[model samples]
Target: MLTKPKILVVEDEIIVAVNLGQKLKKLGYDLVGITSSGEEAIQKAEENHPDLVLMDINIEGNLDGIQTAELLRNRFQTPVIYLTAYADENTLNRAKRTQPLGYIVKPFESDQLRSSIEVALYKNELEHRNRKNEESLKSTLNQMESGIITTDENGLVLFCNPVAEKIAGLSYAESIGLSLTKILKLEDSTSSSYTLPLSDVLISNQTIEKNGIFAVDGIGNKTAVSIQISPILNTEGKSSGSITVLRLGESDNTNQSYLKEIHHRIKNNLTVISSLLSMNASNLKDQETLDIFKDSQHRIQAVALLHEVLYENHDLSSISFDLYVRKLTDLLFEVYKVDRSKFKLVLDIQTPKIPSEMGMNCALIINELLTNSFKHGFKGRESGSILIRFSLNDEQYFLEVKDDGVGLSDDTIAQTRNSGSLGLSLVDSFVKLLRGKLKLENENGCKVTLSFPTRHET
Candidate 1:
């Protein structure tokens, strides 16, 4: 059950107080207390914490009803409605200063009293809700990772989140009333001289986004950040303030070293695993089993080499595919013991560096294709050439591997589609992982083409 809106009546006349309490009860409001003095009103209000206070300004006490209402407004934020016989200019002006929600003459009708109390209650509820919402918004802003600062139209700091304080090296107490220029000292050597200050942006009612900007703190530490500022407008659509968002720049050296270390560790572990495989293969007397171990070792080596490139290069996140392919082909040549005089390896790797994961997958795919060509295509040939090409367009990647050797028949190609060859199955899974299409054709020699999106399309 919902409780009634409680009313505290402060009337000196006993008859009038009892009558007013009766009227409130009939109107569905609870008469929490009836006090005859200002001092009793304050005590009763503190005890009951009524939703509304019906105060008689001419009440008997050291603190008149006006003074009590003023104290209640400041301390408890209790809504007040003045009930008095006095309607003179002097009394009205004094009550107005107390900021009472409603004023009614002593002999006011029941309908008038009811309407005044309802309006005051409704307005008070709205104010409380608005205050709660503001607190919630402040909490959310303080929890954000991005530094946010809001300023008044005059560029005075109105609010700054906790992240903003850390980024600026300034406390909220010191920053609250300071100018934005003083609190957040921003400098941009790369920006043009014509670039406007954030204050100018506010005045122009324009939004701005700038990168490579530096913020200098009190201790003289400079931090790079990307800044975005937008104008905050009022209901009239006029600019009222500005909201600034700052994203800290990447930790270039620290991030690069961390990523490089990860790749280095991965490469070392893979090398150790491959060494174990090689040792196990040497003990195998069966030629077919030995070949299987060798194939697995080569696949591991292919992925290891990709990590090695990523670890050594300045770009830790990606690998230079062109240089990587060259090294990979050379390593394959040494492993297969292919005589340079009998065979030629041609590479046209004109693709940009790709992420390390993608590079590893591509390396393995290339390893399988090259291994198949060397093992089957050049089975009885004295001389042949293997050509590898990789290129990228705006939307997709294109890879082609061709060999001028004995080609397979159409029937063989069709049968291989259903064949459970481990190497071919790996290639098929990799192609699907990349969301790509593969085409194999034999025009005098074997030619394979694979195309896929350059970026993952989540």
Candidate 2:
């Protein structure tokens, strides 16, 4: 059930006040109180908290009806309607200043009074709802993480949230009414222009996103930020204004530091294991067992080298494959004690940075193949050249390891196929893990070629 609209009556004459109260009750409005003075009306209004006030312009008090209505409206947001006997120009003008909801001459009809009160109540309710929605919108915008700023069609700042004020290095009071360009100093990282293309956005009526942009402050301090600007269109599809959003381009520095530290610790632990393997290999009596230990040590070092590269680079996602290969080959030559004058290492690497997991597999494959060549391929030769070529084409990676040494014997090839040789067998397994194809050739030497997709393919 709906509650009745509460009303208070203020008239200097006791008879008129009683008549007005009776008429309000008959109109389905709850008459809270009747008063003969402005002071009593205010006191009654405060006590009753009526929804509407029927105020008489001529009241017996230091404060007139107009003065009391203004105070009630301002303090309690109460709606007031004037009930007066005079309609003189002076009295009408004074009553209008109070912004009453309705005005009536003396001896008004019941229908007229009812219609006036209904319209006033409806209008006041609509205004109250609008104010609440506006406040809720403001609160939401203020809590957003990204900086938000709105401007008029002429580019003057209309409103900006707290985040926007912080990013622009200005307060809301100082920014309003100023040109958006003056408030926000944006510099394009790819260009030399310091101005934003707001006109283009307004004309095109489209949103534009920019990355690697710098937000410069008043004192020339620049922070990397990403920005998006969209035009606010009216009902006719014409640009009315614009809204801008700003976000920092750089990620959390603390998280990046933590990741680098983790990579560094992992590398250190692997190095310790590699050193322990070398120590045990020195005390081995059987040459075959010692070679096994050496191969394992080299494999461990290969993975450790990748982590070292990752720790040193600013980006922890991937490492430069070319640089990593260079370091790996150098370590292999030093470990095998190959004389630089007799053995030549040629590298034709064109691949860029690759993920750590893929890099580790490739490193192990290279280590095993090169170790095989050093142990048996050039056992009776005085000198030979090894070529390590890695390239990418058609969304696939190609890795080739070739050595100009005595070609593999028929028996050795049979043993490799039968898994008799652990080195070649391991290479085959690594190739299969990469979802790749491997080919062995013996034109002038031993050439091993492997091909795989850049990403996993079904």
Q: Provide TM-scores for the models.
A: 0.50, 0.50
Compose the digit string of candidate 2's lDDT tens values, residues 1-458: 89999999889898888888889888899999998888888889889999999888888989988899989988888999998887789878887887788887788899999999999999889889999998998899999977899999998999899667656756677799998988899878664646788999999999998888877655355556789999999999999999999876666467657977798788789888988988998899999998888788888888888887665433455555666788899998898888878999998876645666777788789988898888888888889999999988898889999999887777665556565788888888888788888878886889988898879866
Candidate 2, residue 22: the lDDT equals 88
Scored by lDDT, model 1 comes in at: 0.82
Clashes of 1: 0
Superposition-based RMSD of candidate 1 using all C-alpha atoms, in angstroms: 26.8
RMSD of 2: 28.9
RMSD of each: 26.8, 28.9
Instruction: State the lDDT of candidate 1 residue by residue for 3-32, as single tens digits.
Output: 999999999999999999999999999999
Backbone clashes for every candidate come to: 0, 0
TM-score of 2: 0.50
C-alpha positional error of residue 397 in candidate 2 after TM-score superposition, expressed in Å? 62
Please state the error at residue 327 of candidate 2 in Å: 55
